[model samples]
Target: MARHPVRAKDFAVGEEPATVVVGLIASPGPAAEMAEALVGGLARQMGERLPGARWSVRVVADRLVGGPAPLHELVARTRRRLLDGGWQLAVFLTDLPLQTARRPVVAHASSAHGVAVLSLPALGAVGVERRADEAIVRLVAVLVGGGDAPVDVKPSGDDGGGKHRDALLRRLRELGTVAGDDRGAGLVTGVITGNLRLLIGMLRANRPWRLAVELSRALVAAVAAGVFALVTNDIWLLADNLGWLRQTLVGAGSVLAVVLTLLLGADLWERAPPQRDPEVVRATREQVVLLNAVTVTTLVIGVLALYCALFVLSLVSVLLLVPPGLHAAALDHPTGFSDQVELAWLVSALATLGGALGAGLESDETVREAAYAYQPDRSLTG
Candidate 1:
């Protein structure tokens, strides 16, 4: 049986554990969340790798220190802040999209210092915190230099095959030299486990209440659309003449059309000019903007759904409120239940159009912030 060389005992630094403080920069909400997760995971991973190390994580709030700046400059500024603040490490987590060779890189660490930057977009709708944990561990490995084994940070999809993988691995090895030597195989397996853990964590994070709050405004628009659909009688005859399938398609198509219109008018594709002082590359920023646009579109779809439901309820109200004979009299060529069904669908389409007004009522900043989960103008108080 082969013995595993890297274990808890191998990391025992001394009786006195060293403490490392990490500074987090970015949007307040997400930065705070990321800071909490990173700090929590440090004791678990680093304790095994460096048993005598203690880690503290805090979100940085000083305008003089944090904001949407170029990565190199952000890192340099953060380094100075951390050092002056008597901290050991600084990590800037940004929602800004980052890519290398058209492929997303989740994180990058400076070889000369204990500073690192991670992109939120690279987390890609999964165990974001778990990926962060793994990336942080890899960063620490490079900064502290304990494990002699080469570190591999390539994300799941690498198109370069053998040469690319080998070159990246060599570059990582050259980053720093550590005290212990272990085959790279175990480290690879650990990272794979980290990815799996992230998937599960994301699943748990998606609770119903959070989703409800996120879509509350959209739901309000849907209800308003439904109300407008119920009260209007001009389209009843057209609806009565149309087939169920056609009605559904019309309703769905209307919702989609309005959504596209909103996306175009919203200017989600606009990008900030490149900065020279900090020197940043925004190759993947458009993709992030596109994603936010889609999110806003989804809200439009949700409003349409609400409007349909309310329209149905309003139609039912008509049936209950008005006498059967009266409803038939109201329709010129009424066909009983069939006429009502047609009327409902036709009204839904129009109501969905009205929902566009509600969407427009939403402030552009609100929609943008909701789409990305980051409040750009928000400043940390106290």
Candidate 2:
């Protein structure tokens, strides 16, 4: 059975299959160049596969276009154009936005029977950007289209689950090696941690959210420091109160933080030396504004955090020492209150450490700096 397609008959020959629109929806504001290239690649591949089967290409700007439209609402305008205008098979694309954890369900409802891949949804789940994910997206698209009549995709019947899981594990193993670079894998870690860093910076820059995160971190720090101080000052306090298992958690948490910090910190990361001069590379007004601010904030927070960590470390050391010192002093002068005052000082220091660490965890910006690193200025007077 042959049916003429909407506006497609003008181009498609008789007996051509139903019209398929290769619509490329990109976040227009950020990566116009990249999206354009990917769309072109998709169109070319579909054309080669379908062979004069009437392929039309269109790009939707989701950003300049604005978002927050629910699934049907978001694609309402586009869907109308595609379905009414006669696109039987519609394919969509988008960058996985950091703000939302779950994808919009309405996206599924909007499609009359379309496929969305190379989308922010898929790339996000796979933990990679569009560039790295381009090939994977192509493979997925071919699968959705029931395999290319031009190039048949084998169904191996294996579900490819084993291979997919293996690839995921391999990527995870390389996370320690390529923690920051956009080129490599470790997408799972990158998306989760990198997105959090992005959100923290954004919230910090704005007033109300900034205040909220700051207050929350401060509170967490206070609680952490207070708890640690109590545990340290009275070594057997928790053991006496909660018994061995619960008391052990306090020490375990401390040890875990040390291990995690070392793993995540810039010091442990093996970054390749920058090839370009940061100063020579002229940043756009916007990049300079955002990157420079993030860079400065990171440095300030980092310095403050270092001092705070040292303070906590010193206080902890003092906590370990003071109890014995105070006991001896109290024995020598049983009525003296100076020993008690020193004990109070130790508690304050430990609490301060916890507070500082909380702030540091929130504000650590080293990876962000490396990701968008600038060329160093070597234009000093000779």
Candidate 3:
């Protein structure tokens, strides 16, 4: 006699596989983008890999974390959302970098609550999407299978067995360490690589190019200054005389000046919060330092992008408006393409200095909104 292949529900005759609904609550911006991009595929993958149940996913964009909050409290809040929405499992994806015991946290999962919180920055600045996909699958499996289940969930494409599995595990470990307690079952806490990974991740999240775009007044001032320098004979002479070393120095100095002006004028620097507890105070100080570093780096990148734009604009103006013969006559020497480039270089530097003055026109709120480090209620004591 021939036998039929048994289905999972066969043991409990006439039973259907349970449907498990998963909620992906993502913070606005990158977190939302990631969640939206992965939701459909993630749901399908979960259904295929975990055969006992059918999986469905929903994405919600809302800011869940802004200031310091206890891990248990965050879990509780997420659990409430899950229960309220009738979700069997919930994952909170945040762009903000999280830390516990001075170590960066990548993901924290609570089997009891059926919720997990992932700090995107702790995944590093590269390959974040793939890493996040793997994490979500593994976390979902762990949550659904109870705390005793294996944390590793190999991708369906993996055929190398232990080697591929080991490689994946190693990469995940590099992202963070697994730390947990009674409050949470699976807690992964460790820096991506070191402090540099956090800095790079923060920079990526800041999107400094947007900062350059927002400084409209400064850009106008820079263009005006570049135009004036292009028309002046004295600037032509100075560009002819100044060596490449001096030109580089001038450019670096101008960028530094703009960075400083923005930092001071806009008051972008952060000060550590006052707290009675020594640990809280220390943690806040570290956070302040990281925020300041991110702020300064953000300004530098923005100013440098502005400078590059000015240089390109000046170069085109010099090429179109001033003839090579006229430039050579003004410099009292034979000139070529290099002379035009040098002129543009110097003009951009001078224009950047003018931009520093124009930066004052931008309100503090405008600049702060463009930066990722701006958290209105960021207090460790809270």
Note the residue pairs that clash in candidate 2: 71-106, 94-120, 95-120, 96-120, 277-375, 278-374, 278-375, 278-376, 279-375
lDDT of each: 0.48, 0.37, 0.66
Task: Kindly list the per-residue Cα lDDT of model 3 for residues 156-248, writing each as its tens digit.
Answer: 345653343343233222222211211211111212123344446456656687776777777788778888888999999998889999999
TM-score of each: 0.42, 0.27, 0.52
Top-scoring candidate (TM-score): 3
Alpha-carbon runs more than 4 Å astray in model 1: 1-225, 265-301, 369-382
Clashing pairs in 3: none
Ranking by lDDT: 3, 1, 2
lDDT of 2 by residue, 77-178 (tens): 443333333333333444532222243221231111233323344333333344323442343233232222212222223455334323222221221122
Task: Give the worst 10-residue stretch by lDDT in candidate 3.
Answer: 181-190
| Candidate 1 global lDDT | 0.48
Candidate 2 lands at a TM-score of 0.27
Residue 35 in model 3: lDDT = 95
After the best TM-score superposition of candidate 3, give how far the Cα of residue 378 lies from its true spot, in angstroms: 23
lDDT of 1 at 242: 70
Arrange candidates by TM-score, highest first: which order?
3, 1, 2
lDDT over C-alpha atoms for residue 232 of model 3: 95
- Please report the candidate that would top lDDT against the real structure: 3
Q: Compared with the true structure, what per-residue lDDT tens digits does model 1 show for residues 310-374?
A: 56765786566546565566675445766666676676676666656655665554443333221
